[model samples]
Target: MMGLSYFWIDGGTYLGFIVCITLLMFILIMRSFDLKLRRKFTRVAMAMIIALAAGALELGLLAKGDTSTLIYAALLLKYILEGYMEIAVIRIVGRDYKKIQSKLLWIPFIVISILICTAPVNPSVFYFDSTLGLFVRGSLGYSIFIEAGFYLLVGLCICVKKWFTGYQRDALIILFMLAVVSTGVLLEEAYIFDNCTLTSSSIGVLFVYVYMYAERYNVDSVSMCYKRRCFYSDAAKYAKQEMAIISMDLNDLKYINDNYGHQAGDVALLTFAEVCRSVKTNKFILYRTGGDEFMILGIKSSQKEAENLISIIKEKLKETPYTCSFGLHMYKPGEDFEEAVVKADKAMYDDKHIYKSNKNKQANKRDDRFDEKVQSFSNDIDFFDEGE
Candidate 1:
């Protein structure tokens, strides 16, 4: 029998325990965090747990003796578990399984599991070698590579696409780690190594979770503003306080996007976010509540203070070339926060419409002036010619 030291089972077990405890601690501590983030932590943690089991079973697969039915069955089970773990990693990288794209991507991996379940009968992916007394592969053996490399590329694409908004450094590190895991998996496929898959995956997943823990603000990726989820949490936390809501909406954002590009629209949104966040005050909090809309929740007792903050926002916005309209609402004690937000949103739309109409009128007025001046000049030239 092969010695235990060659398998690295001890190291894998220790890493698995560390990852499990870290995830549980984070879940317990971040109870107030958004459900999506918490769910990701839980899923990754559970995947690591299963990975630990799979690693142990792999040790049996490599046992130095005639392969039995039980060992073969364990191999098939490990394949199934690895497929599930892959889906989990994909979800973590994409972060939106409910979306159509995400659903389409992961739904195929189920087919991999189905294929794996049939491995014992067909041995297309893997089977026991009765002659050489080892695990061997069939003609369709590369299905494993097709399944893993596919999602690894997809996940890498997702991570690379989200390289900005505080995830750039994280993405590069994650890419390196995943590359290491991929190399280890490839090595095992060639029968060139053992236990590398579980060890590399555990280390990579642990690093990802640690990075996420350090950056757990529920931050909106595009605008870098506090996300909408935080709005609900904060509202519930401060529901009883007297507060003023300032609803800000970017003017002509659709025009900007349609004219310049979506990138420019993103730039405008980011600019608005920076202006709101940079405003000096601890009593006020900024949120990008919606596309082209933002909110500043002032916790102080005065409506005038809210207005003053809005005024400051306007002044800061003028310094930039972009334009936005804001609505100010003072919430009475015991008033519903949502109701106050609605009022502010309504006021913001009213202001935005007025702003657009005034700009149109100003353009028309300038056009009229140009026409009148041209007419006067033409009349003067005609009179002078007639006199000559």
Candidate 2:
């Protein structure tokens, strides 16, 4: 029994060492990429360091046959540090932390903290003593349940955030952390049940280290909407089906930014995007290609059908303050995708030039009205002075 307990303690400490070393290496490698360290990196490193120290202390307590208050404190410290690190990462990633969905993430941390608090006070009730009579503290049910719940939260955050925005590399790292913690909890349960001769937590921690190394050294690729990569990967698969591509560019966007502030320019862009989304006819994929340029692809019947859809979009924009120039193109059999895109782009540019010309003409008319007013006021003042 003593030998087995020693083995578990040693295994946990080894796992902690592996996790810490990997994290340190990961930090060094991340510096090579963006090197910003941001706030997320600092918190993550601190949390892992504390966890490693706690694991060492846990082994010490096991060897002494007395679980000291300091060891318990260290364990709680590790949990709190890890939880805060996750929250920090979420903030640094600029996710919608105020949303209701984020509350799900806190639930596991809260439950786990409560369980760990109760474990020392009610060890016999919470934990099961092994056949060898070792007091393997902490409830397997709560541990596994909380770990799995956290994993789900992290995974959902990663997948959903990536789907909406292209920034997902940090989220992927969070997912890796979730996997490591989950595997540790599961292995601990297996060890408690005597189903496993060795705890696999160390191996899991090692995997986490490898993932960190990969994240640090590897160039993280960003997902783009209209880029050739995503288009070929997704559009080609749907090439056999009818697809309508509508290309658009915001009218007078540069003029707006130059006349007004950039903030107003941003508002115009956001408003245009919202208007486009609201005018959705069917299942459509929207892409922002260049500055003030966007495209919407939908499954449609023919070129005329695509034009009708663009006409509807134009009507929707007419109701709004901003206007956009649009061009429609339907994917035809044997048509090169890039060439078709270029044709659509050229059409949109032609429309954009026409819109800009009309806008300039209107501005000239307004200038003429202002000049007429100024001349009439000056003539009236001169006549009044002569009469005096």
Q: Cα RMSDs of all predictions?
A: 16.9, 12.2
Candidate 1 residue-wise lDDT, 230-316, digit = tens: 777877788878777888888767866875677666767877776665663667777788888787777764888788777887898
Off by over 4 Å in 2: 1-26, 29-37, 85-151, 154-184, 192-243, 263-286, 296-321, 357-388
TM-score of 1: 0.55
- The lDDT, on a scale of 0 to 1, for candidate 1 is 0.68
> Can you give the TM-score per candidate against the true fold?
0.55, 0.61
Instruction: Write down the worst ten-residue block by lDDT for model 2.
Output: 379-388
Q: Name the best candidate (by TM-score).
A: 2
- List, residue by residue over 117-137, the lDDT tens digit for candidate 2: 665567632432334334454
TM-score of 2: 0.61
